[model samples]
Target: MISHTSISTVASIIQLSVAPVFLLAGIAGILNVLAARLARIVDRARSLEMDVPTADAEVQRAEIRELAILDRRMTMCHWAIGLCTFAALLVCVVVMVLFVAVLSALNFAVPVSLLFIGAMVSVTLGLLLFLGEVTIATRWVRVSEQFVLKGKPLYDR
Candidate 1:
């Protein structure tokens, strides 16, 4: 019983929803990267944890310090993942509201705009956290390498 006008409206709504759907795909890709980094961090942490107990005193202290840095990196990565996931969820809601507004014959422009803004903010923060995590990991590696190259062992051989 749908008229041509209704079909056209639905088509327009679908067109409008395309950008957000693309955004969801982008978010999924970011999530995949974040998850992979988190996995590597976890694996490294586990290996360090296993080595900590039997390490000599100097090596044990260094391992503990490294573990602390790893813990902080893990926390930042976790938050990034959470924020990005939230952003994706908000985008989904925005798309749903767009279609619901059409069916209910109500204007949802303000809510849609607000939801999109929230999503952007969340994703921005998520990326910032990811950057922070990467920076810490890179810095730690540089320090460890410098110590090793200068005739100081950073870990037990």
Candidate 2:
């Protein structure tokens, strides 16, 4: 009993819902990049500390201070990225739910039903990405410990 206009309206709603999801995805991408850069900077600092002469205590202390700052910054970046990733995932879930609810309410055709299925798949992918980020972040502490406390190169045996 749903009219053509009602189906079109539902389609528009689906499109509107997509905007926030896309925005969150963009934010998540930026955060991912920031987190990567922070990690790299921390790694470089660790390597520099290793190469510095051991006899120069004052210089070594200064380098250690710098490394500590970089470590704190990297930790902050990791947390920020994690928070943004979780937020993006929540936004994606909300959009998917809204899309499915609207399409079902309007009793749309096969294509709209397929679109809802696709949205669910997208939600699943988002959740996977979020989980991956968390896993990487958890391992970061181990990586930092190896580089700083153990003074081991990342690729060393």
Candidate 3:
């Protein structure tokens, strides 16, 4: 029951979706990076938790502070991963709607445009959260505190 016009329409929709498919691939790469970061954060936090129980009072205090920062970083990473996942899902929906629009012979320009915009917004938010975490991780880092002698770090002295 499929007509020639219908076949061509389907082909056209596939062609249109090629770019979005590539976009999905790119998002997958970003998601991989975000997930790996989250895993590393979780691993570090777990290790710290194990060490804190056996440490002296001062070390325990320091460990607790470090753990708090790690907790914040993990939270940010979780948000970043969540937003990126939402973005990828939205992109998938956009591709599906594109196909439906073509098959149904209906205008979905507005919906397509809105969905693409939403995906971009989600990606932006995710990257922003990741950047915030990196900033926090680096801002209070002390390179010399752990490597010091003669009032200078060994590496820099």
Candidate 4:
């Protein structure tokens, strides 16, 4: 029973919602790439430690410092991604609310309510994943710091 104009309005609202979702997806992809690079850096640091002579203390220290810098950069990237993800999620919530409002106004027979609920759940899951990544990056940074300052091996207890 909804008029054509109402349906078009709903479509427009949904279209507007896509921008934030796409932005978040892009940010997430960047973070994933950064995480992989950090893993590689950790592996290279380990390899360097094994190859370096213990008597060459200055060289060993320099390598450790470099690794620590990489870790800090990774942590910063992780936090930035986490913040972007959180903002995108907030935008998603607003979009979902607008969607529901438009659907109700149209009085469409379709169960668009379920779609709105699903969007909310998906955003929640995304937030949780971002938080988990942040936690991991923070631990990695801490380990790198210990290695640089105390001569401890990475991941040491």
lDDT per model, in order?
0.96, 0.63, 0.91, 0.61
Number of the predicted model whose TM-score against the real structure is largest: 1
- Candidate 3 ranges with C-alpha deviation above 4 Å: 145-157
What is every candidate's alpha-carbon RMSD to the true fold? 4.9, 11.7, 2.9, 10.6
Clashing residue pairs, backbone N/CA/C < 3 A, model 4: none
Q: Lowest-lDDT window of 10 residues in candidate 4?
A: 108-117
Comparison by TM-score, 1 against 3, better one: 1
Q: Report the candidate with higher lDDT, 1 versus 3.
A: 1
Query: What is the descending lDDT order?
Result: 1, 3, 2, 4
* Local accuracy of candidate 4 as per-residue lDDT tens digits, 1-157: 9999987997898786787567567657755765675577567667766756663778878767766765655565456555545555555665666677676775522344454445445555545555665565566555446456567666664
Colliding residue pairs in candidate 3: none
Q: What is the TM-score of each candidate against the true structure?
A: 0.90, 0.55, 0.88, 0.48
Per-residue lDDT over 1-157 for candidate 2, one digit per residue giving the tens place of the 0 to 100 score: 9999888978888787777767667766766676676678678777867856663878877777667766666665566556566556656665665667676774444654454455445545544554654555565445555555467576674
Residues 1-157 of candidate 1: C-alpha lDDT, one tens digit per residue: 9999999999999999999999999999999999999999999999999999999999999999999999999999999999999999999999999999998899999999999999999999999999999999988886456458557686644
Q: Rank the candidates by TM-score, best first.
A: 1, 3, 2, 4
User: Lowest-scoring 10 consecutive residues by lDDT in candidate 3?
Assistant: 140-149
In candidate 2, which residue ranges exceed 4 Å CA deviation?
A: 1-6, 52-55, 104-157
